[model samples]
Target chain A: MTAAGFPIVRAPAASATDVRIDPALVRRWLVTFLREEMIVRRGMRTAVVGVSGGVDSALVAFLCAEALGPANVYGVRMPYRTSAEESFRHAGLVQEITKIHDVVVDITAAVDGYLRYEPDASPTRRGNVMARQRMIVLFDLSAKYGGLPVGTGNKSERLLGYFTWHADDSPPINPLGDLFKTQVWQLARHVGVPREIVEKPATADLIRGQTDEEDLGITYERADRILSLMLRGYGQAAIAACGFRRRDVRLVWDRVNATHWKRHLPTTAVVSPTAINEFYLRPVDY
Target chain B: MRGAKSRPQPSSLLGLVPRRTSLDATGPSVELAVVQCAPRKGDVAANLRRIEEAFAALRHDRSPFPDVVIFPEASLSGYFVEGATVEVARRAETVVDELARSARRACGRKVGPFDVVVGFYEEQDGQYYNSALYASLGRRPVLRHVHRKLFLPTYGIFDEERFVSRGTSIEAFDVPYGRAAILICEDACHSLAVTIAALRGAQVLYVPSASPGRGMEDVEPANVRLWRDVLRVAAAEHGIFVVYAGLVGFEGGKGMSGASRVIGPFGDLRAEAPFEGATILRVRIDLGDVRVARAALPALGDLEANLGQLSSMLARTSGQSVPAVGARAARRR
Candidate 1:
């Protein structure tokens, strides 16, 4: 039985639906993890977060303000000229609610300057450039303000490889990295995030009228549930039997397998008996 | 010469000394719970509140409540305070009174009375000691036993000797669960202390430790493995049950290993908590096993026979000086 007097229920081997989380316990765990990772392990008193007006970034900013004082938390909003006005407004709402130090850096010139040389550049290239530019700004502010840059990407996006490498995925500390996108929404509501932001359509805001579901061809709710079942070693057949479409299960399974490289360190050819991070290993805190 | 001859012969040769049978045979069985909690550093009230919440949670679930609840060493004020002031070291009586009240309030009328054993920096007259207080709660609370740490570790990452005064005595005190003894963290490192307590009729040894986790691998921490070996050997050798309650969480950038466990007299692990986070490890132990194990081995009986001889040998060696090693070699040549 858990601390809440609820017996922990386990799914049978043939079943595929056993992903339940206690939000209160998860909140306590995440808060403690953030406090320990930032203050105790990294010796940082301040945190910097990139708030994009999305649920994921909004939740990260709120958690950072809760872990470290609002004065110590800095929220940066990086918007290109073509970014949605609603996104900017939502970011402002988060800043006001969390009461964190806010900075707005318009990246229209930085992104457009790089794109001028390649006017025929694809949308993906432009989106990647914008994401990297925002990261550079966030990191510079982190150095100037003596705060660690916090990552806002969630587990669902990470498994789907829906982020730019070394851009949106790189941070010294990440509180929401382990939580699924659906779980992030759940925790956002629990932490009193703005309801408008929580209910907003998930998007990258890099291009006009582009939504995450439209790009991925699957909803986060369905994808998160499929990923949950897949993570528990459930086969595609088992997942399909659990009231999920067979094609959706197969798509998520293939995406997770194809993007396995994004989740791990670069593979090194081992010549020595003990390689770094293999045998002669130490924790990042160490 | 006549008086010496009339004195009784040593029990080793004559076997005239009647062996003291195990008291555990007649003692009642005990249920014990060890709490591995992450305490907020130097926050006494918050730590107490955490303990209260755990206790209330256990009772509300109607789980098998333990007869004795143990917390980690320095759990009230935390460990590794460089220069603790008098305000940091709380009065033992006050903490005990509060715990007793909380325990009674949480488990009142539904369960049998239980005792709480917790570690804290205790303040007496102008001096402080790293101590464990055992409070037995029934109609009211009673401070049953207090054991100050005997050996203050002064090695790497440990400057306990510089911070707190050392206790000078080893004893076994009677509690609700027969004769039991308390040993703070470093005291468990000394086998002689455990031996002395076992010899003094302690059937159960409660070791409250604040040992930090040390290692680089994903397996059990080195300190945790070492503590397990220590507790296992002590329990098996002395034919006593051992309960080790360890603190968890980080303080001053150091991580604590929270592998709290209960070991039976046969050196078997009854219950063990994980290496991280907060957990309550509970186990039911039949005190009769202490008597059964000792009756099978009878090492305590052998120690009783040789204790006098060992004492005399130590006395004689202290009174005389041995020849130098070089001189003895030269004489032999």
Candidate 2:
């Protein structure tokens, strides 16, 4: 129905255009979020972010530098054996602009050490090993440098289950979890991120010529719109009616539905009235 | 302590004639402050020290000290405490005495009476209730009133009803400034509580809230936007001053937006704190505005008279037993 509810026809509540955000307000808000979460709650003065030369990590590095001083933010670049060389150059661009502390730890030997035992491992299995190895290095660096690791995942990647289940989402705090990938681009540009890195295709560097949109079977623009609409209680038919392809909408919806387990802590069976996670709930930092 | 200068006789505050006895049930133009501070989760001693720092900050900033200061709900213990409610909960009387002692010690030789309205988890008997206390500190310490939160929001990110027992009543108790009532957080979201306060001749409604900011689809946090609408409507329709004390800082990953504000009887914003971290919002509120607004709009007056006409509808929808203190407050009116 329209504003006045008549069952005959309905106007789309929101379309892809509604995905725009106020970048200045978001920048200020997330800056305070990072500062408060790190300094006040965790009692840390530094943030360690694995800068992939991607927009999400670049934006988080900029925010971390602004929240704590530039000297306090550590931008670590962990490239795999077959990783693109452009990833480091782009991360260098972010570091030059942010003037953050830089550290580079290559995971070729560590990931290869684990993969040597499994010679027939596929690219997906090898990618998970590389990703998990990167997490181990960043966490150990956090302990050594006294800086907490900050997450760089965005809403689209999270909802689509694009990132590794445990390795990528293991950070203690995430400031960009609520922002979509397209919105992340909007924020990265507003925060004075270099145009070269912001315009680059997002990649996990799992294999040569591998891009996120290619693996996901949809563009971030289309997927973000569908996810945004679906989040507001829109169904597959309703979203497709808004000029979205039924196949694309179904693909996005299926990914979101299939990944519900990835977004939550491990589920436990309830034997009695109270279960570990069922009835026992506590606030974070508890 | 500065007592009401125009008191005609020495009288007990309770069981007074239920009418607007003095100054339209209005009183002197009072200086008020809302202490919007963040309490650490389940740490009352640390929060008490935080409250003391807020008091010191207030004394350093303002002059002609405030007559009243309000704090956000669960200011002693943070919100979202599920199984820890019993551990964090405290007796209202004991907390009031401790608040009085702290206030006196902070004031140091500067003696003046001021009322403190603070929210906490209350452990009375063996039950736990989300409660707020209004007590005097400084010259003459007195426990004036206690209001248990009537509405326990149990949806979305909230699971309040699961951990704590719900309060049964909405009552407007007598305050020195005028007859005022306490509505803790979600309690003010309901119009019935505000209407009950207006019916009981309360000119001020003290609302202490600990709301996590969400819905980033707007320029401001959506929770803050909706709260402004709720409070403005409550103040304008009821012809009462609405003092809102909001919690600041993050609990878990949830950001508590702090824009502690005061709305006048005419629905005009008097003062507001920033949305950043903790800050004290102080403003002067005239109780006579309550008399002026009620006289001009007169909606509460109509509500009182026409409520009997809607009794059948109410009797049908009144869910449980006697609305304990709200019914008593309405009966007095």
Candidate 3:
């Protein structure tokens, strides 16, 4: 039986006659593909979403639990030594409330141990190392349990140079890439993310007592409003009207503009006679 | 006074009040034929006439009439602009006017509530855009809602960026039967626009393309295996209907393999047209497909998480660290 409550209709084969296409029908087809291909055939599809205990990860964990069942969704809480105790607590509470698989991996030991080889590392360099370590931990869990890793970064984070390279960026899927931080909160509430996770101070919790706004020099509410306006094709003045500092808004814009390469597949030349650009395929095996 | 119970409730200029035709708990089990036409090179008038004739033949004939007709990429102007000027690239108004007239006429003839979607080369302020027009009785012919091929295929056989500007907006509007979204040929390959439309609550996706290729007999053959894999995966994941209306027949010596097809909400091939010439395909879509898919997998509910993972991958690629293979391996254990 199909997931849509209809018996699965397997066509014998594609005939030259099977070529008439309707756009409306295609949408239904893709949804069905996701259900059968990813959920059923894949089997025991557990997923891990790295939660900073902020709205984005919190919301993602909640939704993954809903999609894969609480038992199949795993929540990984990776906190650095500088991370606030509350961030860890909130992640734990979110896991308990949502009933998702939860594990706490403290990376301070591994990071600090690695940094001993190089004592003169700058804060930014150290931060990047810490972020990558956290990703290493999450993927380790994914391998152990057999699932895909989910990400929590939003358009705001992607646009603001707010994430670490090769760290939180790499995931099999990202549910909130198009959404702004504000929109993430809306979805968080809709998905019943814990109130603590929703209302907590937005922080990467990278440095001791650090917060995202303090590091970026702008609050998410302000940054998200600016980003929303910009994405809708508005100009600088229109974005500034949203109460964000003009410099901060421009910074976010430049970050998104500069890092656009990270958002796409590797740029390959369409050199082959029949080589279509941007349709390159890579095989994956588990 | 003669009994007026049978008289059509005095027609109104403002809008025709829909009569209470028996509303079925399940929507009409009616099949819809979606046809894509590749207008002769720069011949808008011929294209309009061809569309009119197809509409007439389908509507008047005892054979089944399609609920909607779709046209290929720039089918209005044949997707070719000779002189790069506004006068040369200007969209012929005849296509829009004729399409609206056709829809109104079809409704009047009770041709089963028809709608027409056409693509054209639109020129405005010295800039040319690859645009589409959706004409129906319930709504006016809307031409500005264009899906300019976002990822312009500047290489191989495609040079879209050189001729057209990219479209920024993603729109899905309400149709009588369902909310519909449009993505032109190259747009379909990218997940961004499709995901945007899905997020915006569109239930039907229309892909109008002038896809070029040969091998009408072997194109997307079931025996090939990979195309079927693609079909099964794309349809089932999105939980929405997808209709591909591709241009067929020979144009400028290049064979257009019209492998137009409709995939059901559950990712099943509902109907398919031939790979050559103009062909018509019809299939009935039940809205229940989406509901059922959601209920069975319960996966769509976690759409945010799924998208978040992709976004994270995007973030990971930003920095210099090799995408932690260690991370991928960890998720498996």
Candidate 4:
């Protein structure tokens, strides 16, 4: 579908050889456009996505650019003092590639400023404070621009117990909520993200030296492979059969199984015969 | 060789013919009548009269007055009444005085006897809700329950989130003939609603919908079919009976698909109504059948256990339960 009827702006694939859109990818892209129209037609103005210098954000930025236009899309890159120079460089690379306007706000001052007032916060708590500071900034910007803050967290983050709720993660809109990390990479390449940025190690960059895979103690390639099997209703034996160690399989299972609540809305016990959310979400409109 | 034994077996035909085995007490079978109709837009008076007329005809003809009559979502006001304030108020009728008068008049003027489950817009505690009123003749009509929609879908010609607040509750309650449950249109798609109803021991699930039927320009017929099938799966999984009622005819330029149907505990369609005009379907449902099916399959038992796990997981993630040192550090907001 062309731009006349569709709102998708597919970037030139990584190379001329890979120009064709896979049938599955095309189907998903159409669904994405439909979803965006659903959001925009409801009167939302713009979208703000956290640019984490990772494949997830890159794909999200591209999709946002396609759905809402480059002018209607904004990116916020919050890098701490220890943040990799590549974080700033790649974010700029994506902005130049996509031509979406962005704000490079440094949150070190804000994070340190707040921490000085509250001394007893733990390392995890402090890390969360940094994550939430970025969100607060994004939301403030969202309100200013009358936009929705789009989430960049992929399915891997959601499945592997990687996200911090209401802090490092959680957004008003999640475009890539259903895609895995591997799929994120595939989309990033298809959307023409620079190889330098796409190949870089994934990280929350909460602390200067931290990387996500290091913190989770597993590589994304292995993690995604394990998760794919798990999602298919496979057990530990199948995971082990796929070359994942028993402990690694157990860890992935626990992460997904234990953090199940992150995937759903709050639960309400049945009290009346006609309970909303108990049987279904009743549409208030006719 | 079998002549001697065959002669003795011939003495009792019960020993030869395959018998219909019934597990529980078989009571005197009573005809249960149900009216499924496609209501017009803001034509509350007309819809009420139509229902009255249908019931009156049923009684006079001795066709059997429906024991229970269910209408579609916001059937009185029709679904898409545009203005926020006027539309909300127009649809929201409490029905204490209005429905009582209608019931008495309906019995005398139209139907000789009947009970009703009518969908309407209602305002309570200064909050507007998509509500339903259950009325019975010769008795104070029970309000039954009102459910505000939970997921306000803003996708594809839908802007419900703009006008309605999300409901925070999921429940089921008892009605006269059996333990009955009700769910609105979109509620029929979500598993949580059906699971909760089954957990509460509801024997029959009633869904009244104003689903956009075929040729709405924007809406598809497939979505309607999907919702209908999902109802069956939910009913079978929960070991409960489901009665689906939908509104037909065009309202606010959008068509309402009126493929209303009823499914047994095993996901078999017991009855169905056409997509046009008002209809009254009477089918006898034995609660004992539900008991027999549930006893044989015992699926609801696992649903209960799964629900417990779901709750604990929710409590754990929300940090609603106070945690120790490690847990406190992870507590967000």
Candidate 5:
């Protein structure tokens, strides 16, 4: 029961796994948020999105086109030399469907330029360099094209810290930040995203044969269920008791706790009486 | 010859017809539902789509469906929208007609020759009203009642007066189940509106509101407690059921109070929805409960008898000449 004495009925476990969302409600919410937070509040007329041919970025592009017309939306596809041909093809599909202005930036030179500094850089370092390089291109185009860069990170990836920090997570505004990966897939289907892109294996497309589940060691379906339980205030023991493997539960819990710092602004040592983000606080709009 | 007189013994005896002991107990009961929804600010089309979805969900239930479904204040266009021009205000009749058609089509023969009451900003004759429409849905649709907001609250975060016109009168009208009346958000705060409704023979009083919840930690939001007290007292005092359907959402930094509920005529809490989410609360009520409560305490009868005297006193207090009893009665009729 809630504090107000109303019974708290949890969504059925099966339903939670399949997460029913009212697409119209979500569409209206995103449209209103963009109108208020971007155009009306921040005085921005155009939006720039980095479309990677995955469900998350595809969903973001569709939402931006819906909120601001296709003429005002700019889709940037940044591909490295080793990037999959399917990635470029799906990105083109998004551009065709949304009819938004599109640009292709080849980042192989920039990435290889940095890789020359350390020939033995690990795969993780190389992936990070690619992610950061793509962001650099997106941000630069945003400035040159006079648009604000919008993010495409979903909640599951964010909670699991699957993306490179300060690279994919640095966009000024994001419409997909709160939707889970599974929910994003549902919304993608509802908003007319191509079936091929929605059904493809989730990946960052940095390596030749990398899948998100293989890298994270947990399928998105299981990860989303566990994350939903944790969000509803279930403790580690309680979640395991609900028929989940204890190891997986602990893994998700540890990841969420470890990545807490990535969700907040940098900590500043307080020197004066009222320091930034301490006593001298201001609202986001302010 | 002497008497002639028993003045033709009175044709009929006074008070011979037995006073109705429990009219509500004899009549059919009604299943009522209140939908506490989070409306998208200034998005009428989306909000209407959501309301239709709720009705569709109710249609699938095998149990007895609600005879009347109530949505929160401004459920069509949202509340606190002072920035919306008159162009955004919807015509109440057109919206209600469309909703009735949809409801009939969705429910089919499974349910609802029922009525739906929803709030919206009503536009008519170059003026706008914060209004609630009582629409009846069957094979065809009928506009039963339209209650504009009587009290336009303008304190603190409320700027209703700046956006819409105030309603002119308070009266109860007949519905399929029984007599009922409607009061918009701030109107529920005024006791006189409830009294007038009950005095005018309302068995059910519907208070649809968009009151924002405000309070500190560990304490109930003030509007929740206030509306509860109002509904309870009005129900118990006048023996009329009270339904409060409050909107739930954060609009421009203001969070609405979402504790929509139904109070029985005896002041019993029937059902209450949550304070933060979108929910449909259902409760079955016998209009006979009103008769049961009224029988226990004959307040309505007493008030009806004393109204003429009160009117006279009011006239005197306001320094106006009192009309002849016949003329006053004629005017009332």
Candidate 6:
């Protein structure tokens, strides 16, 4: 039940077309976006993607390979000790198919190096540490490899605040940032990502058995529809009329409302009217 | 009465513009070039260099460019420079002089009796405006007209209203061949600007836009699709040629898809540029088509004839006091 006094009754699932996209158009746009943002705008000819065997990163790898040929893309596979072996295999699948510059830098020692000091740290903290440590490796490699660090988080995870804040969304440019997870899967299929990787349950691979759906308590398919509708200014009553489960709507809405800060730059106290990003803005270079 | 006889003609008496009645019955043909550009953000000098290169290329190949050349809105500065617009803003007079000089230098000779409509952030009387300048560049250059954008879109990725002051006028200016009007970006979305230009006997409407392409659900970018619809409708309804020039390249991840095109008098796609990058969409437009189309429909003619009556009805509908010229308008029609 929602805090707004709605029932928790289950409803029929929405048609996939609710989050469907024209894959050809989307692929072209993303390729253009990647080239413009990374190469044309910043003079970075290459890109390094932190491929985690998930659909999102794999899709980004495929796009980067297409944008700046396969040779220019470095697909770095980062696995902690607890990460599933399937993660490494899937990341390998992406590298094999795209023929991207394959690289594997296991982050176990780096994550464990920090966590050994805090033995009683919670799983969430430990996962965050792993995520941050992977970012450190990817960024350092970006310098060594002479490539931009491509972001792989989709709009659904961004809205749900599913990924670590700075560590996951910290890349300078993202081709998939605006696309919802369902749409990302659609684009993934169009761009020829492996069927197994496309069909697999999405996971961060920070824990052994953790899946994103299980952690979020809702399917990405449902959450995306709700998030898209909510952002389009549909109220609770309007959304409920669209045949969404009240419980799912509540979960998606709460997460989106709660994690709004994760999507933004740190808010600074405005002592002057001309505060940057508040009153002052230079849109292109931001 | 605000009928055809009482219609406003701002420059008719000055003899700067030939009145509509005096124009040849068989209107002239104009070769138009809509140049899609990816202007560097906050760097007016770099963008100017690009503009100069475009002119150089055009003049080098064809000599005297074309009858009309249109660039995208904020061609002098990229679209989303919110506060940086103040730094890039130029006075209209200064811009025309500089543009003329650049064209002459690039062409290595006196270049245009041609019209060039270029959009820029403008500063006049200590006020800033998003403006499009229509000028005839040659040995004797004339600042034909400057259309300061009237409707500044403030919501949804646009903060134009906050950065620039709104323009209050929408009038067609006389080109060497015929009358034409400029509508910068958001101004084209509002039908009133087009209607005013149509009433003033404009045969061509130039829309310079820097609108970011949005949505992935369709085969084409959503904004591009919508702009096509609007451009088509505006062209066909008013029996005018609609030339749209769009910005290409991404601005902070917002891709401005360059789908610039020319919509004919019959609401058909005359010529279209590619969506990916900078390219010129060149097409020869016969102004005679305007007369043929308007003759076929006569919608603009009927509206101009009965405007005084419609104004009173509109006032009544909006709960305002009605004006007194209904009988005269009906009789005039």
Better of 1 and 2 by DockQ: 2
Ranking by TM-score: 6, 2, 1, 5, 4, 3
Tens-place lDDT digits, model 5, residues B257-305: 7788887676666677766557788777778777766777666667667
Docking class of 6: medium
Q: What is the TM-score of each candidate against the true structure?
A: 0.54, 0.90, 0.46, 0.46, 0.52, 0.91
Per-model lDDT: 0.79, 0.83, 0.63, 0.65, 0.79, 0.84
Model 5 per-residue lDDT tens digits across residues A1-286: 8889999888755543344466755665566566555775567878888888888888888988988899999998888898999999899899999999888888999999989998899988999999998889889988898889989999899999898889999997777777788878878998899999999999999888999999988888888889988987889888887788998998899999999888877878899987865655433333
Candidate 6, residue B59: the lDDT equals: 73
RMSD of 1: 17.4
| Fnat of each candidate | 0.02, 0.59, 0.00, 0.00, 0.00, 0.93
> Which number leads on lDDT?
6
Per-residue accuracy of model 2 over B155-260 as CA lDDT, tens digit each:
8888898888888877777777678889999989999888887787788899999888876666888888898888877888888889999988888778898778
lDDT of 4 by residue, B1-75 (tens): 000011111111112111233224252233455555655455577766766665555666545566676667776
- Please give the lDDT score for candidate 4: 0.65
Cα deviation of B140, candidate 5, in Å: 49
- For every candidate, the chain B TM-score is 0.85, 0.87, 0.75, 0.78, 0.87, 0.87
How accurately is candidate 1 docked according to DockQ?
0.03
Model 2 / residue B69 / CA error / Å: 0.9
Clash count, one per candidate:
0, 1, 88, 18, 2, 0
* Models sorted by lDDT, best on top: 6, 2, 1, 5, 4, 3
**Between candidates 2 and 5, the lDDT winner:** 2
lDDT of 5 at B65: 75
DockQ numbers for every candidate? 0.03, 0.52, 0.01, 0.01, 0.02, 0.60
| Cα error of candidate 1 at position A98, Å | 0.8
Predicted candidate 3 versus true structure: per-residue lDDT over A1-286, tens digit per residue = 8678998868887432122222222222222322333464355477877877778888777767766678988898888878888888888888988899888888889999999998899888888899899889888888988887877778778877688867878875566665567666655765677777877777777777777888877777777766666766878877676556789778768866888776665677786754533343212211
